[model samples]
Target: MKEVILALITGFIVGLVFAGFKLPIPAPPAFAGVAGIIGIYLGFKVMAWAGPMFAEFFK
Candidate 1:
């Protein structure tokens, strides 16, 4: 929860700065960005779930 709040605050500030400078925000469009993040998180979780099983199998 703390990390989520901090990330929101930082993103808001960076957004404001980018808009003030009239530059593009350095990220994908909203839905794509969220989907990408979700994909990355899922990938990490999948690896974590499989890692122990693979290690035991290879032993």
Candidate 2:
């Protein structure tokens, strides 16, 4: 997707700049943290999709 590519490119640029300046990268420093963020996003998406379905079912 366009958004995904743009995000990756932007992150790469920021990372390079941070490295050049010897500053810490501003992001989760571990895979588990990244996974948790992804899990949260998925949870939100699932609720968004299911909320309407359940509402219609109960009506």
Who wins the TM-score comparison?
2
lDDT score, candidate 1, position 29:
65
Candidate 1: tens digits of C-alpha lDDT, residues 23-54: 99877768988899999999989979898878
Cα shift from native, residue 20, model 1 (Å)? 0.8
Residues forming the 10-long window of minimal summed lDDT in candidate 1? 50-59
Model 2 lDDT per residue over 3-50, tens place: 999999999999999999999879999999899999999998998988
* lDDT for residue 8 in candidate 1, whole number 0-100: 91
Q: Estimate candidate 2's RMSD in Å.
A: 3.1
Q: Point out where model 2 deviates above 4 Å.
A: 53-59
Number of the top candidate by lDDT?
2
Clashing pairs in 2: none
Q: Candidate 2: worst 10 consecutive residues by lDDT?
A: 50-59
